[model samples]
Target chain A: MQYGFFQVLRQVELAPEHFVIWGRLTPPPHQPILPGSFLHLKVDPPGDYRMLWRPYSFLDYQPDTHQAAIYYRVVGEGTGQLCQRREGELLPAIYPLGTPFTHEGVSRAIMVAGGVGVAPLLMLYDRMRHSSPQLRVEFLFGARSGRDLVPGLLEEFGVVARMASEDGTLGHRGYITDLLPEVLEQGEWQMVYACGPNPMLSALADLLPEGLPCQVSLELPMACAIGVCNGCNLPLRSDGGRYPRRLCVEGPVMDLREVDFAALV
Target chain B: MGGSSAAQTAEGFSLEVSLGPLRLSSPLIGASGCVAFGEEYRRLYENSRQAMEGSSIAQLGAIVTKAVSLKPRGGNPPPRVAETPAGLLNSIGLQNPGLDHFLAELAPRLSQLGTKVIVNLVGDTAQEFAELASILSQKTDFPAFELDLSCPNVEEGGRSFAMSLPSLREVISRVRQVTDRFLIAKLAPNVCDIGEFAQAAVEAGADALTVANTWIGMVVDVERRTSRIGRTTGGVSGPAIRPLTMALVHRVRQAVRVPILASGGAVRTQDVLEYLIVGASAVQIGTGLWIDPMCPLKINRGLREYLARHRMSLGELIGSFQAEVSRGG
Candidate 1:
């Protein structure tokens, strides 16, 4: 459950404000890093007493390289400190927490991401590449401007990418859902996976064609990525009505149908 | 040397104690109302198969259910929990599926756990407590019941049953009539002296005691100029309160002869050791489980290793320090 910090082997600034760091975890011999699981990073700065730990989902897990990547925005003090971590620094972490995305029975899929939500999708795209080469995948990434879109990474996965931004610097001048209907009409997709802002997810749930299986990854403030805290609870839709479900355990990725979006939003 | 080595040396002389009729494999039971009802982390349990192979609810001393009541509670509103120095402040308002649903839904699931399920029952009045206890006693699988007379957030005379001997005795006596099952009265730390309450419960036919629920606390939002928690007050827990909890446990142990299950502020194996040494028959890990779901298993492993290293068994260690106290060593 606890992992010793591997070195911050590389760091890249994807945008003017965004950054991604790759840490090679010293996985206690025989531990294999998976695609969608995350790691809780111990980013307590020396002599600076504030927050305890921050969790970031894994972007890429290159087991051969013993490297894992995490993409983050400079949101607060914790992220700011994490961004400042230099190469060769040991960032103690708890890895591969929570269930990974289930990619089965689907031939073609569409991934919808808003801002930093694209991190986990990148790993999923890589894992599915060889197994389903002919799988048609469309990635719709939304941001404020073209500069916000992560360059070269999506294309390297051989995914057809569409960009949407509020300022019109990207492919479309509106939200990601503005182009979803057109894309779905054109492609014969079986499933859709999305991770983004609450509004974006709400819009997708409202507008998406019914009967298409959709899974969503929800982000909640978590002290422990594990289920014990019961901090991150989302209302789940059952046959009768909604009930509080643990996001950390029941899922970080759940079938969109099981979520009571109305209650959550 | 680290505390683990010291713990190893001390574990050799633990003892086997009984909390009423329920016997334990080891006295280190997961704290009631801390860990959820069942195993919530299937993946982590599945991944660490070796560590979790034999130990779970089935192997543990006992598993206590979260506080249940006759009526369903919505609980408090958000900012329910906030991090303190080395502790956490929470005012969950005892949100639980009502007693009927609990028996129908949760009881069936819990029956599969293979461990003794000590139901932590809370109520507004003595009548309600007796009624619920009566209903619970009728169930064939119900093992024991803990009267949570110390939940701080309830508006109807908050923790009044715990502060006074008369009310505490009346509540325990009323419930004891309906069920011959083990009755443990959980106490609150906010009181002036917890030993008085422990003595009262023991006199009322209570089998054991769970020392201390969270100490009431509050935090302010500077800009909003209001309390952080919706209820304006919350219960504080975690490592920060270990010293206070240990003192309370020791005091209660001296006053009462019944077994005490030490809770509140337990985060590490050493903390567990400290409780056992100070006359606690068992220890429960609470806030630590929130930081790491696999923490209980880790603590269990660590405790076993500590005992093994010192060539001692857990039963030989309980109340071993009490002798030192009596002799003034």
Candidate 2:
């Protein structure tokens, strides 16, 4: 974990209420941010002294330039303040937090994303592409509409994703689950990586092929990503334990089978 | 002010405070549940290189651990917290890894850290509270224990022990008999006449009193027609409760002869000073850490600068509130 001022380098509007922010770390992280790790950015101003910290997974990170990008969909007051920030302004943040994805022995994997949930999975794919040249990686991304699709980022990643949108403006019409059966048949997949809305992730948990290992990045609301405030709890299966695990520390990435989807309320 | 002592540094400034029998190097304390056995903050400090100027845990007077119960509690279900206007509402329900786990796994690491660690205890009955205190006192050489009297008493029809004077007296006196170590009674803020409770706590053998715990509050999700937190109501803490708690500290001070450890909303150095001026022996930073983990460091530095600028000792600043009388009333 590292805390420093990150100056805004650029901000791109991916869609209405969706954005990609690039910031330069004043004091670069001690270690490169690993795939599935996130930065806890304080969106509220410094003068106010009332901290409003939000955790955002890395969309992309540059170790040399000390530059990092994060994708956010404006949802509340914290994200609202983040969107209005401009270039050259610095954001106070704690970096490389939470447990990252563990893809040690994997040779083939499919990355499934819903909306801006594509952020962390992109990082994991980048890691796999660099570390294991022989790895076969594919992406199945879905959004609400064509405007919500991040074509620029996908192009930058050099990924031609099998896409889906609810309104039929993109690749496949309806939910990503509609295309999952076909995608599962196409690849002799060793593992699955998914990130998206809880409802979508919950559905994916039920739909995945049995015995297929999967890691999911959760989107639970959190305060003090350091694990003190027991706010962001990930409910686990009854057999796992009676207590819920803290998503900030225990996960933002967890085994799909371990989470209790029905008990998430 | 039984053990309160101040040693002036070469710069002629001091941050030391005494809470009855206990003494500390600095006046700032990490409240219960905020530091959580000190491991998380220790990891952060080690990773961040202790970045902020003097924000090390070593600089704090003490840290109150999360509530330790007789059995491990699962806590509330999902959505344990909600952000309000400058405050946070939480229903964590005192989730802790029971006494045996705490003493074996968590307690050992606490002594390794330079700061003083105060265990926060919660139980269903007065005897249960005593049992926890007795075991901890024998097992660990920790400086003190803070009683979390806000828990509902099963023996007394589920009413909070802190709400009724008899229940409050029974719990404190029971624990007081079992241990000679310093004891702090944490008062619940929801009751009427908070000052009266403070007096009852002190009379029942509490060495000091943590002015109050989080205020009871609720936040509704209008769209879903349900509570934002897992529980119907949650404890509220942060800047929104700072003013309210500071007043509680003053009121408690008025009614008690023992030291007062102020706990509620203390995010800034100014907030700490306000609590001290209103008669707090020391200030505990709770949700303030969520805002800035280095707050203890920042507040410590800020306090030093403020004291140096004023050329006053910490003892002089505490309970220094001056009232402006209005004759018309």
Candidate 3:
């Protein structure tokens, strides 16, 4: 990980509530942006110095140009401040942090996303398609409404996502997990990669076929994005016999089997 | 921005200050629990060119490790932190790898950091505190111990130890008997009169006092209608607490003759200066490290610039507040 400034190249409104900021790293990222890795951007004004660091997943990255896009929803103050940043503004950030998803020994995998959780999966999908041409990747994205879905952004990457919305204004009326049973029946899946709200992830974990491996990107409230503060903890399964993992380092991405979903409640 | 009569060069600048018999190269220190055992901060500093360009962790005077206990602690449950206006509320519940692990794994690594390491000890009882000092004194050459009598998150002995004079004195005195090294009693900010605790600590043989720890505060999720933190309430830290903690430092300085190591929401050079002018010998950076791990270097640079502009050395600036001019109330 490296601490440096990223000059804002552009800010685009992907949807009504969702926004994406494309920034060019000054010193550039020391390490390549792995699938699950993220950037902790200081969103508070320069002089405020309140340490309002909010971690955002990379929506896309151009290694040659040293530019990347961070997709986020204006949920709270941190993201609320981030969305207002204009082009040419320099924002302080730490990049390529947290353990990346383990994509080894996977030929065919299903990518599940809930709302803004689609951010990291886009990066992962691009990676898999480029590295292994024969690999088959399916994208199942769910949101609160049709307007919240970013099929336009997905199309830019040459992906056509099977969308789901709770309001029935989009593809399935109920939830994305509802389609998993039929999606699993279509082919033999090697791995499941997911990122989303806790309730959705818990439901996905329950719906998964037994012995199927799943990698999930978890979110927790964090003070220091580095490991020292011990603020963001990813509780381990009760039977796992391990201490709680610090999300800043150990993961933002973890195996669904190892995590204790019940304890998270 | 302002012209200076005596602008000192980097070579001529001195960030050194003394905390009683112990001397520090710089008055800035990494507060306990914030920097962990120094390894993580060291790694971040050494790796980042931005951090290295200005200064390194070596520029800091010393670092206080996270609280060490006799046995391992599981710590608090999830949702352990919440953000406030200009601060953070955390209930880590003193999660540590126990004393044996600290000595074996952490202590050896600390010695290589090129900075003084002051062990922060917390215990359920006075005997536990003494035993921690006894074991650490026998095993490591660490120069000082900051008795953490005011960890607000813990339910049992930790929360109330610093509030009550008898327990605070007993812990400090027991640790004093075990080691002659510099002992700093870290008091709680949630107190009736901080001066009383400061006086008791010195009378019981503390060489210095860390003005205060984080004050108890809480945050709630309106949607969930539940506490944001795991334990419902946690220690509130950052710039929000600086004014209150600075007042405590001023009170403690007046109550005791020992040197005071001020720990609060010191994020900038001016914050450090405020503590020093208020009569603190040194300042500790806790949440500031979260803001910028390299803040010490920036503060160190700012200190030199300020001193040069004023044509005053660090020694002259310390305890220079003119409270005597104030009329009696």
Candidate 4:
């Protein structure tokens, strides 16, 4: 984990209750930043109201600018205060935290995201793009309704994009699960990655055909995202045996076959 | 009280202690459920300059990792934690990677750190507990196994194993047969008579005791009309639980001859000293680490200064409190 003090270079609202924060952090000597890693950041501590470390997924990073981007949804008071933080405000954050989704040696893959679960997928998509052109990728983005959806987010990734909204606000009117079978039918998917709330990921885990490798990113209230506090844990699927893995350490993303959907959510 | 000798005063006070079979370089071990298997905290310690300066992380005598079981356990559902006034209520359901993987991929890494690795184990039955201990006995590297009977997170065996005397004896006796390494029975503070349970653990062949685990606690969100923590209840640990746990540890020390490791509400050096004064051989830093990852070092600094000032080692401070009808009144 790379721990350092970073300055808030930029912050903006992406959608209702969702925002992106950009910070310039220098990795501690001998440590390298990896994709899919997270930042255990501290919200401003005001008086006796001590704050706990909040985990943010790595949205995207630019080595040239020495800045990393994080996407967060205002779930609580800590995040609510973060959205109001001004530019040049600084906070301490631990970088390259938790496990990253591995996208190695795959020629074809599809990603499914729900709401702000799109946080980590954006960086994973960038890596997939920089990889050999032989690798074909498809992006499927979904939300509760049109207002919750980011217009033209799929276009920036330059991949074959599809969309679905629960209220028929934008694309096909249904959950992302309804759109999956058709995507898997069009091409032989070597890998599948999903990130968002548990229900969305669980539904995707249910739909993905057997033998298809699916990795899901979990979102939970993590106090010490470095694994010390057992706040964020994911139960492994039926085949994954009985132990629950800590999301802060072992994963934020794990194979869908291993996540015990019924046990966790 | 004896006067401090000049020679004794000149020497650097040691934080060393012998908890029966285990000898620690410092009386500071990361509490179970708070410390991870390895790498997660170490990488954070190594990468942060502030956490590395002046004092080192090695001062952490050991780490008692989150509980592991014979088979993997899918912990309770989300909303696992609720922030209390100065404490945290958590029902993280003994979430672990199971025994086989811990032995194969994890235990080896624990030894790489310059501290003891005390693996915590739990089970639904005595046979399962024995199987877990048997597997770890062969590893040779892990110095101890903490039989966790105080967790309030699970649903199957809702009542704690240590809550009843017979069950505590039965589980400890069975697991004792499998491993010769130091066996520490981690009991609960919620028991009706903690002293009786302490004697029960000692009689069952526990070499040492962790006095104790988090107290069962709950918080309700009036506006939401739901319990703050998922699973409705959790074990509370933090500054809020400190005094109550100190009393428990003090009582357990008086009842049992075995060394005691204090688990709850250890946030600063003064808290560590207080536990030691009341007869805790060591103190486990729990939820405090979440507030500041460098808590151990900061506490170690506070402890060292206190030791140097009084020219007393940790041993001298342990069980220093006297009980009497009058203080020479």
Best by TM-score: 3
Give per-residue CA lDDT, model 4, range A84-199, as digits (tens): 77678767667777788898887688988888788688788888778857977778888888776676454455645587899998888988778888889999889998887788
Q: Clash pairs of candidate 2? A: B55-B297
TM-score of 4: 0.77
- Structural similarity to truth (TM-score) of each candidate: 0.75, 0.95, 0.96, 0.77
Q: What is the RMSD of candidate 2? A: 3.4
The superposed Cα distance between candidate 4 and the true structure at residue A215, in angstroms, equals 4.4
TM-score of chain B, per candidate? 0.88, 0.92, 0.94, 0.93
Better of 2 and 3 by TM-score: 3
Q: What are the per-residue Cα lDDT tens digits for candidate 2 across A1-265?
A: 7767778999898767889999997778886788899989878766676656888999888888988999888878888989988898887788878999988888799889998899998888888888888888779899888767778778878787989899999899988878888888887999999998888888898899898989999977788798876778778985354555899998999999888887775
The candidate that achieves the highest lDDT relative to the unseen native structure? 3
> Chain A vs. true chain A, TM-score per candidate?
0.91, 0.94, 0.96, 0.91
Better of 2 and 4 by DockQ: 2
DockQ of 4: 0.30
- Poorly placed runs, candidate 2 (over 4 Å): A238-241, B1-10, B151-158, B325-329
Give per-residue CA lDDT, model 3, range A135-183, as digits (tens): 8888899988887787777887777778899999999997988888988
lDDT of 3: 0.85
Question: Which run of 10 residues does model 4 chain B get worst, by summed lDDT?
Answer: B1-10
**Fraction of native A-B contacts kept, per candidate:** 0.09, 0.57, 0.54, 0.50
- Please give, as one word, the docking class of candidate 2: medium
Q: Please identify which of the two predictions, 1 or 2, would achieve the higher DockQ against the true structure.
A: 2
Q: Name the lDDT value of residue B214 in candidate 2.
A: 88
